[model samples]
Target: MHEDIHVGGGLVTAFVAYALAAFVILIILRFAFARLRFSRYVANAPLAEAGLYVCVLALLIAFI
Candidate 1:
């Protein structure tokens, strides 16, 4: 008999953790840029932040 199981649990969890960390780092970068008045040079910062948030949510879902 054969059983179906997933062996990538650790990988999935790691992906989730990495995504969360990336999200946090990106947020911090965005905040620092805004505070330093460099946001104008990087207008896509908000978009990148939003994309990272979405990626984090997706990774969490994937891990589950």
Candidate 2:
């Protein structure tokens, strides 16, 4: 079994850790996307970003 994340408050569950990691990655991805002018190419920028977030979240959960 996987270990829980130790935090100042307490231990966070594995799924929560995966979600937090994914969110951090999404933040970095947002900056890169903005620098690349990604929104200009997408028909629905927010929706695309949301999809990216879900993909990142899923990958994190599956791999780690």
Candidate 3:
């Protein structure tokens, strides 16, 4: 007979950790972009931010 293993809080913990990491990364990127006057060059700042967030999330998932 095979024993079933239970992972208590493991999934939730990993999710929260990834979310926190992404938030921190986005904040750092925001400051860097602000310092470089990056918004001035972008036609749609909100859209760009969303795209950046998705890209960053994908990268985190791919590499992590």
Which candidate should be chosen as best, given lDDT against the real structure? 2
In order, the Cα lDDT scores of the candidates are 0.62, 0.90, 0.75
lDDT of 2 at 43: 100
lDDT of 1 by residue, 1-64 (tens): 1233345663244554556666786778667767887646666767766776787667555655
Reference-based TM-score of each model: 0.44, 0.81, 0.72
- What does the lDDT read for residue 1 in candidate 2? 31
> What are the RMSDs of all candidates, in order?
8.6, 1.9, 6.0
Winner on lDDT (1 vs 2): 2
Residue-pair clashes per candidate: 0, 0, 0
lDDT of 2 by residue, 1-64 (tens): 3688788979978888777889999999999999999999999999999999999999887786
Residue 35 alpha-carbon offset, candidate 2, angstroms: 0.6
Q: What's the C-alpha lDDT at position 48 in model 3?
A: 92
lDDT of 3: 0.75
lDDT of 3 by residue, 1-64 (tens): 1233346843344545555678789889999999999899999998898888878877776777
